[model samples]
Target: MTEVLQDLAEYIEQKRSDCVISWGFTNGELNISVAPSNITSFVEFLRSDSRCKFSTLVDITGVDYPDRTKRFDVVYHLLSMYQNHRIRLKVSIRESEAIHSIVSVHPSANWFEREVFDMFGILFRDHPDLRRILTDYGFQGFPLRKDFPTTGYNEVRYDEVQKKVVYEPVSLTQEYRQFDFMSPWEGAEYIISDDEAEGSKLMDGSKGFKDTLTSEQKIRNFNINFGPQHPAAHGVLRLVLELDGEIVERCDPHIGLLHRGTEKLMESRTYLQNLPYFDRLDYVAPMNQEHAWCLAIEKLTKVNVPRRASLIRVLYSEIGRILNHLLNVTTQAMDVGALTPPLWGFEEREKLMVFYERACGARLHAAYFRPGGVHQDLPDDLLKDIANWAEEFPAVLQDIDELLTENRIFKQRNVDIGIVSEDDIQKFGFSGVMVRGSGLAWDLRRAQPYECYDEFDFKVPIGKNGDCYDRYLVRMEEMRQSLSIIKQAIQKLLDEPGDILARGKITPPKRAEMKGSMEALIHHFKLYTEGFHVPEGEIYACVEAPKGEFGVYLVSDGSNKPYRAKLRAPGYLHLQAMDHMASGHQLADVAAIIGTMDIVFGEIDR
Candidate 1:
């Protein structure tokens, strides 16, 4: 690790020829954070420098710190495709200013930078067509900043004449948004009540409301709202597209309509309490989401899961991956006018969900994973069932291939639609099938092995065209790979029979005597009421989820609840590439492009 960092420092020094601000590693990966002014040169050097040919931009996200000297920090994660090394670049800027945009270096940074600008109010200098990418147009203030009110600045009224919604600024004299770090119910003070706003209206008539923009005024160049309702969109995501005929001049995705402020909510709940919320983040694959969070907490607390538990986690996670990818591909096919594939995909997925039910006792929102270990051990019958399904899944795959792989209409509609190049994948810091479809052999499970993935022998599939068809083919192949992993995991489980839950802090009392013994009852009550405390530290845990590298970066300050929890969702990155993919394509291909990206709005909105 020291040698790797030393080599990285030398690489950064050589690349930055002019000024190398700082270079180091955090949480085991190399990081070279440069000044805002030196960003372009630094990126160019990193891209061209043979030693550190960082060919892919993994992610670009903004962090707000109103109390700090540097008000905001824009972070970029870069990956070296050849070396299989990762680096993080952080550029700090004051609230009053904007930093130079890296979109020119990586076009996928375009939407990501726009998202920063939209949520945190960090301006990206020279960002071509920088606008609100997540929030609605005419949004009053940056939502992610510490000072920004959780409920937003004011109430918005629809202007019939203008055909748009307008925001009316309210008084800054009101109390700050109160967030309780103890429990979700205790955080009621932070919530905005309709009665309070209405009472304020009675006092001043116009004190709380302000007109920002009307629909007619906001509309330009063939603008249309895709959905806060359209089924083609996976969830309640609304996209306002500005088109010049069939060409998308500007594409702005309005998220947060389904905003439950999940991170904020999690910060108020105990580590155990937060597990259920992960299920909500990516409802389609709750197991993957829960596993990512569990891994993050487990890493921070230095808890070693038992061999049996690790194998069970892997088995469940792989099943979830297959289920998620199947649904995504099937739905995407349906969106592109191929209806039969979705039914075929769902049928297989339902079978997997049945297995999940046998294992976790729940299908969609399985709170199966817990810190230190899992909630319970897999039953012998369930194990046999999963093994049977694993054996039979290949036949189902062959049937799916026969149905869609050679179908002329499916091929014609998806072949060249939504072509995301290797450059775009790198720029957007895309992962999973999106990156694989672009020909990059980067997978978190392989690149940074977690759980018992290193023990499993499986292949990471890659695509050539970076098109929708490639994404479909890659996911189809991935399902088979996942089945192979599951089979291996089942074998391991049979070989290792032991306690599924670790015997230490945070372990639940045995169920056998809870009802009869007062001591066990009291223990259970204490565990649920107070929750286990974690050491003061932060850790970022990631897994190769079906959508992409679903990561949970958690900060724990020796509290029952988290200090802060951020989900590094891959769907957000894929959504950012929508414009680039659908720019010149026909309007009808928009659905095909969206389908190909396989974005679940739950992840995107969260």
Candidate 2:
């Protein structure tokens, strides 16, 4: 591994010449810092070079440093499926300068670049149709910038006179007692000025919710809003479709309706407080999201978890995967016409939800995972329930197979529909079942094992075709594999019964210890009030989430809170392929395509 990274560093430096500013290996990954001018050519080399086949664009985001002259640092993460290697490229650019867009090279940078533009106000030159993706129309300043206020410049309220929601200058109804006879909402005079509001349009390139075609051209292609509120969209996704008769000519997805500023909120809170925020990302599989965050923080802090905790994490993660897959398959079947799958699927999901509630107090937003380990150990009876469920799940799965596996109506609607190719998977950065359904045996658990995954024996399912039916088959097979893993994990838990959390300053004292000992009480207070600080560095940790590769890119500045927290949600990337996948197919197939992709807008719009 070291030799390969050394070779890659030497090869890049030797080929790129002065473009390579610096390079090094950290956390078993290669990082290359380059000039902004050479980013396009460098990424192309990484994609095409035989020695470095970093074909997959995992994620692209920006970090804002208001103190530096080059205030914005654009970071691009790439993965090599052939070699099982990863690399990160960073380029520091001034706020005034524009970084070259890699859309011409990767094509998947279409929405990622727009997100960076929307969040950090960084411009990407030559980006086709660059617009605000995760923000409202005519939004003010960049929300992710360091100088931006947490409460924002304006707040929306329903005006009694206007009879509609209107944006007004932010005002505080009551001040917190912590302030020294001053309100947190003070000094808003500067932000509420007319100049800044007017200057906000400097970056507004989109035609604000208007007609794209002239009256004469409208006859050929007309536009319709599919939903920010449509039943078929699954969530709060709003797709603007330009159609000719029954065929969709163009589809533009307008998300961010559920924008909660999760990343910025993570930066404001301590490390422990950020755990619950991830659960709200993909609410269906909250544990999977929290697992990625825990891995990233543990990697940076170099915390070692106990064997028991590892087994518990593996167990719940698999259960969460099955839970998520059940919902996807049943909902996909329901969208296509069959309704029985949902009834059977939700019944099983309720059982899993009970397991979640047994482990953690909450079912949907279970903040069970922590940096060192889990929030607490599982109950004694929970294992018995899971073991019994694993035994009976096969019969339930068989019922689903009998209903939809060969049903004529289900096959007619799904077979040979919304077909995606291997190239499509590579270009659009598809993972999970989307890539596996296309014959790519790339499960991260096997490819790059984490926690106790390497010790467990399991199979990675693959499909021959990349159609909707193939994707469904892949997910169903994956759930069976998950059940196998869960059984193994349950046995391991019984074999190894010990401490769940690692012994360190990071973990809080036990409730019994805190009640009796004064030292333990102080330790608990300090741990919660000022969270454990991590070493100054950056790391990108990922897990094979049910939807796809859910990753957390964290940078710590030796501070309690994360310097910059960016979530690389697979749903966001998968949703980008909707227009391409649904272009030629009839408009009715859009729902089936969306169902197969399994996008939860909570993660996509985050």
Candidate 3:
């Protein structure tokens, strides 16, 4: 691993010596530090270079160091699908300095750069349309900064007089009280009710009611708020749609309503404590997200996961894929007025959630997948049940297919509503069904080959037309492929029976052993209390989550808590292209587009 990185490092330095200043490998992942001024040229070189084709700009983030001369470290993570390598590029700049934007190199970096600007207050020069991407419009301080207060700058409230939401300084010390020194309607030009008139002759021409009417109202195309509350929104996803009668002209997506500051929050929490947060991101298909973070930490520490544990991870990840797809497929059916699919799909979904409960005790936010392995191994009985469930699952899928695949209404609604071409897919950083629906035979499970996925035989489902229907078909087929992987994983789990965790200080000692031995007790004490310290380095690990590619970029700084943690949510990127997808389509198609995008707020709000 070191030797290959050395060759690549040598190649990059030799080829672009003016840009490359220094480079190193941390746990086999290459990290290159370059001059901020040459970022555009350097990134373009990476995308175009034969030996160093880091085509996919996976994520862009900034790490804040309060005391340093260069207070911000703008980091870029890239992946080479063709070369099969990942690299991190770092550029340090002062708080006031703006770095050159790489949007010209990778258009995927648009939202990511805006997010960086929003979170860290880091500026990007020449970004096409840079603004606050995640935070509210009038958001105060950069929430992710080290110095920003947890309580936040202002208390938000609706000002009735102004007829708008306003931000005011929070009075934390005072007990919550409203001091109404003046009447709410003191200055308003409205006639008080007869009860408040305080006069007997109130009806006798005492200026009872003032009529304020105007005929100057002009009509035009309207800007509509689709949802911060509507059902088809999936969760608090609000789109400000500019409409020309029934057709959509522009869609401005306003996110961060549900933002808990996952990245900023992770910086203060321990590795173990932070694992549950990933589950919270993609709530439906949680384990797949946990799998990504687990792989990241494991890669940073260079820990080996046990074969049995790897199989269990694979099995559940496939389950998550089905779980997410079922909800999306059914709800997408519901979006088009067909209510039967969700009812039919969720019946199969409940059984899968039962499997989750059996494995981790929590059905939804199952923080089961740890760094070295899963929290515990699945029992033989559960495995048998899964094997049995796998056989029955196909009938449910086929029944759903009969309902929607050929149904005229469903077909008409989704057939060409949200057509995404291959160019748009690559340009917008689409993944999962978004990528596959565009006819790209690219699945991270196949291209990246994480865990034991390569050993399993499964087909990658690709779509031809790149429309909503094609995306649906890809997901339906992917669910079947997931079942195949799950079945194969069950067999592998039976064959490779061994320790469910890595054998080292990383994995906690068994409870039984802790009671018997002093060394075991010490191991348990340190692990539970302090948590293990990861090696001081940075790694961006991703899993082909059901939605798309959900990634975690971790900067350890050799601490119990991460120095910086940035989540690359595929939904965040996919949703950014909502305007691209919805323009020229009707208002009704908005629901279909959002549904087929398979958006869940858990990740986007982060």
Candidate 4:
């Protein structure tokens, strides 16, 4: 991988001019500094150059350095599916400076640039619609900035006399409290360290609807909001649809209703304290999020996880993947009027949640993943439960397939409904099912092979067409593969058992060791207080999450807490492709498209 990246870097240097300011490797990944002036050309070069076809725009975010003259570092993460490599480009800019938007190069950049603008107040030039994408409609100040207050400036409450909710200046009954570094939840346990609208052209160069319509016959489309409420909208997602009667002329996804400032909170918390927060991102697949974060921290601190811990992490990650896909498929069915799948599917989900409870205390927010490994070892019976479920899940999948995959009703609603092409997949930075459903064999677990995924023998399932039905099929097949991986890992764990947590500065001292040894006690106390210091640097680590490639970008200032934390939530990126897929389709197909993507609003809004 490093060799491929190095070759690509050399090629980029030869082809491009002053666009690349500097290039280096950190945490086994490539990092390049590009000039803000030439970012558009540089990005285009990366996407078009054969030697460096970094066609996918993975993420666009900014990190704040209030003291620096250039207060913000606008970062773009790119991936080359052709070369199978990833790169990070950094361009320093002041808060007042506006950088060129890569939306024309990669249409997925629309919302991402909007998110950066919303969070850091960084401006983007030529971005079609650059408004606050994640914050409240009229919210003031950038919450992600270091100087922003955690409590914020205002609060909303229902006004009894006015009969509506109203925003008012924040009034506190209790003042903001100072930390004494005593709370266990807030402390760092000594872990080892660790768009749119091609309206009339059909976007495929097909005949335009307007070309056929006469002057009086031309339909005028009106915009109507779909959600920000319950029902079919999925979460707080509001789709402002420009409709030509029932058919959707355009669809614009309005997210951020559930934004919780997750990245900002991560910066303020200790490394150990931040693990639980990752769980909240993709609440459905919490373990994978925590796993990615742990990988980044472990890379930063240079900690090697034990084989046993790796196997356990792999097992739980697969389980989380299965759990996530099950809910996705079932709810997808439910969204399209098939109700029985979720009833049967969630039964299996509940059983898996029991396994989660047995492994860690919490079922949903299982912050089980730690810097070096997981919080604790799995119970002896947990593998048995997994094995039993592995045997049982095939029948469950078959039942679901019988009910939805082949049923004429399911096929009618899903088949050829929301078709996405290979070019669109790469342009939108899709991963997991989105690419797989489009018949691309691009599973990060196989391509990048983090944790013990390389050791497991499982296949990456793919679909022939990028339609709604194909996406559903890919997810169903992926769950079976996940089960296969889980069984293999379980067998390996049974054959060779070892310490789950790696022995390092990050892992806390054993209770018995602490009671007997003064050094052990001191290590525990110090780890719980000041925590472990990480070498000053940056790393972007990702895992093949259920929805897509969930990544964590961490910058350490040689402190216990991360200096900057940016999460690349795949759901957020997938949502950007909504308008692309939904145009010219019926408005009712919007729910099917969203459900097929299996987006968790927690991650999207974050």
Candidate 5:
């Protein structure tokens, strides 16, 4: 590990243009934090440096540390294409300040950076076009910051003259937003330096002619806004594309349309309470989100999940993967104007939702996994039903494949569209099918096995041509692989008939037991009130989520609540790939490319 860190340090040192602040090998992986000012330079170094040819930007996100001197931290996770290694780089800046953008270096950073700016108020310097990504325009204050009010910083009123809604500033003096801003670092007294204040004025110049272009002219020449609500934009994502007619000169993705300040909310809630929020992060695959968070908490607490529970987790996660991929394939086809397949896909997904309800009592927001184990054991009949579905899915899959996969029209629309090369994949740090489609055989389940994934026999599918067609094929193959794993897990579940809950107090007593037994009642009351404590440290647990490697980096301060919780959603990374994939393609093909990427806005915005 020291050797690896030293090598990484040397590589960073050699790439002098890239600002490398501090780096070390932690949790069996190399982690580095760089300044955002050198984001483009750092990305170039990662792409060119032989020892650190980190071809892919796996994740880009922003963390709000309102109390800290550096108010926001923009984090980038990179994967080495040659070494099969991963490293994290973080660049922190004041919440009100703009850091250098990485869009030019890695097109995928466009959306991710915008998301940071939108939610946390961490500006990206030199961003082609930066606007509100998630929240409605004219929305006041960054919602993700600890100091920001939750009820909201602005009040909307109808504009009679403008024929649209308008925002008026709400008083920060009254804490109406459910946020407690008692920290010394918070409040309106915090003013920018004179130079920065001047810079802000210049950037926001009212007389600037550069901002006067008509909407049609903007799309025709350089600047293009794809969607605040475009059919292909997967969940209200808006992209400001700087195009040179048929070729994209530069693209900046504006995200945050779904921002709810989830991380901030997580900080206020107990570890267990945060589980439900994870379900909303990647609404398409709640099981994977739940599993990732649980795994992170488990690592921090050193909780022992039962063998049966592990098997159950694996089974549910695989089912979630299959469900997510099905949605991706069906939706991609639908976005490209092929509507029949989505209906067929939704039918299959509806059946999976039924299984989800039976397993966890909720369809999409199934808060199934607990820190130590699952919320409840799978019923015998439910397991049997899942097994039956797994058995029958292949035939349905074949039927869908026959109808859509080989259809000439579908191929014509998707075959060469949205092509992302291996180098582009690495530069963007993408994963799951996006990276795999580019011929990089990288899957978290295979590379860094979690749960009982090491015991399972499965193939990590890769595609030769990283295009829409390859992505479609990869998703289909992955569904089949998910089924195989599900079958194997079902067999294991049948063989292992033991307690699903761990031999500890992590789980609350059942309602019936609590009503009957005094001891059980006490345990339940204590569990609910105090919550379980975890050891002081941090753990980053990643799972191969449907979109990519979804990771949860959780920090526990020996409290019932997590000190900090960070979600590394793959959709955010995949969304970044859009600028690269959509560039050079006609404006009409953008929708098809966006659909093929399979991004969920909930994940991206969060």
Candidate 6:
């Protein structure tokens, strides 16, 4: 694979000599640095070339290197389905510059470019609908920029007299802390000074639809707010739908209400502390998110996981897969007027939550999956409980399968609704079940194979029709496959008895050992306060997260803290396709589409 990537990199350089600046491999993935002006042509070559069919646009994120000559780096992660290879393309530009948008080549670039503009104030030329994405409407500053204060410039609240949401200058005072740390991105010190903070306060210049259009023009297309409070909408997911009486003309999802800047927050904290933050993103499958972060760190540090820990991580990840699918498929059933599925499914979810609580002492946010391995090893009794659950879990799945698979009402609501064609797969940068639901068997576990996944034998489910029902069916089959994987991991866990965590500077000494030995105690103290430094490099690591491909684009400048940690959340892409999917459907079908896509605002807004 390494030689093939190198040869391909040389071929690319030889083919497009003007566009290519540098090409090399980082963490076994090919990375090409291209000129900002020629990135569109370079991307076109990579996508359309027969040998380099990098069709899927995985993610686009902006990395702010404040002190550098070129202040911002726009990164594009692309995956080649035909070749089973991935590439990262970068274009470095100054603060005032703009890059050509590749929406003409790959429609997936539309939302990705919008997010880059929203987070870092990076402009994209020729983007049809480029505007604020993961921020408040008319948001004052770019939150992800290095100069921006963590406590953003503007905030919104519901005033008593106004009775509607109102935006105002942020009132909170955050005292600066000077840590005397030099970050290439965050300038010479850890604390951002007031002058530097002022640089990030440029308000977005885009006008709202009502302000831009005349009353006569507005009457042709009626715009209505879908929610922040509507029972049908997902939590705080508000959309501006341009309706033509019964049919939706356009669906503009007004997200960012839950935007917490998880990536920016990761830069301030040590890698150890950052693991828990991933849990908050996809709270439905907390451990799976942690697994991706841990993998990135483990890959950078070159810390080898013990066989026992590898199996344990796989076990928990599969459990997360089942948890996410159950919540999505069941809630989707409820969205279409069935009440019984949620009732029956929640019972199974409770059973899984018990396993989480038993393992990590937290049912919801089990920050147990760490960089070296899990926080601890699973006991024999807990393994027995898991094994017991594995056997009995399928009966509940069978009951739900029987109830909804061929049910008259269930099929009518989902069968051909919210159809996503095979071409729509690459256009929306779909992954996990969303890609599978569209008849593409593209799974990171099988395609990329992280952790101990390569050792497991499992079948990837493919959907026949790319509709709401096909997605539901994919999730259902996925749960069963996950259950099979869990059982296999448990068998391997019972057989392999060794260190569950890695033994090195990366992994901490056990609490019992810390009390006995002075070396252990000192090592434990230093490990938590000032974490071990990772050798300088950048790596894009991903796991087949419950909803889709959850990735961490981690950059380390030889520091205990990450320079930048951009999370490539699958929900964000799924949410981006709402406009395309729901534009022709009725108003009520919006909820069904949202549920089928498994649109969790935790990861989406993060």
RMSD of every candidate to native, in Å, equals 11.3, 8.8, 9.7, 10.2, 9.5, 10.3
Winner on TM-score between 2 and 3 is 2
Give me the overall lDDT of model 4: 0.85
Score candidate 3 by lDDT. Answer: 0.86
In model 4, which runs have C-alpha deviations exceeding 4 angstroms?
Answer: 153-219
Cα error, residue 141 of model 6, in Å, equals: 2.3
Our model 3 lands, by Cα RMSD against the true structure, at: 9.7
lDDT of 1 by residue, 433-455 (tens): 88899787888889879888899
Off by over 4 Å in 5: 1-47, 60-75, 90-105, 123-132, 152-232, 238-254, 509-520
Judged by TM-score relative to the true structure, which candidate is superior, 1 or 4? 4
Query: Given candidate 5, what's the lDDT at residue 170?
Result: 62
lDDT for each residue of candidate 3 in 498-557, tens digit (9 for 90 to 100): 888896767898778878999988988888789889889877788899999888888889
How displaced is residue 5 in candidate 1, in Å?
2.6
In Å, residue 225's CA in model 5 sits off its true spot by 6.8
- What would the per-residue lDDT of candidate 4 be over residues 1-606, giving only the tens digit for each residue? 788778778878878867988998987888888999999999999899877888999988899898899989998899988778889999999878989999899988998898888787888999999898887655766677776757655767799999999988665432332333443455655332112344433433353345355534344556788987957777888888988878998888888889888887877788988888988889997998899999999999999999999999899999999999999999989998998999998998999999999988889999898888888887668888789879988999998988887889889999998898899887888888999999999999998888878777888888897899999999898988888998899999989978877777998878899999999999989887877888899999899999999998899999899999888889887888888899999988988998998888888877
**Candidate 2 lDDT, tens digit per residue, 503-569?**
6888988889888999999989989898888888999999999999999999999899999999998
Candidate with the larger lDDT of 4 and 5:
4
Instruction: Give per-residue lDDT, candidate 2, residue 384.
Output: 82
- Alpha-carbon deviation at 516 in model 2, angstroms: 4.7
lDDT of 6: 0.86
Error of 1 at 348 (Å): 2.6
Model 6, span 1-606: residue lDDT tens: 999999999998999999999988888888899988898888888889998988899999889998898999999999988799989999999989989999988888988899899888889899999988776554566777777766445667789998999888764322222334455565554557787444323211122223355543222445678898876676788898878766898998878899887887888899898888988998998999999898999999999998899999999999989998898888889988999999999999999999999999999989999889888889999999999999999999999999899999889888888999878887888888888988888888998898889999999998988999999999999999999999899998888898889978888998899889999989988999998888899999999998889999999999999999988889888888899999888888888898898878889888
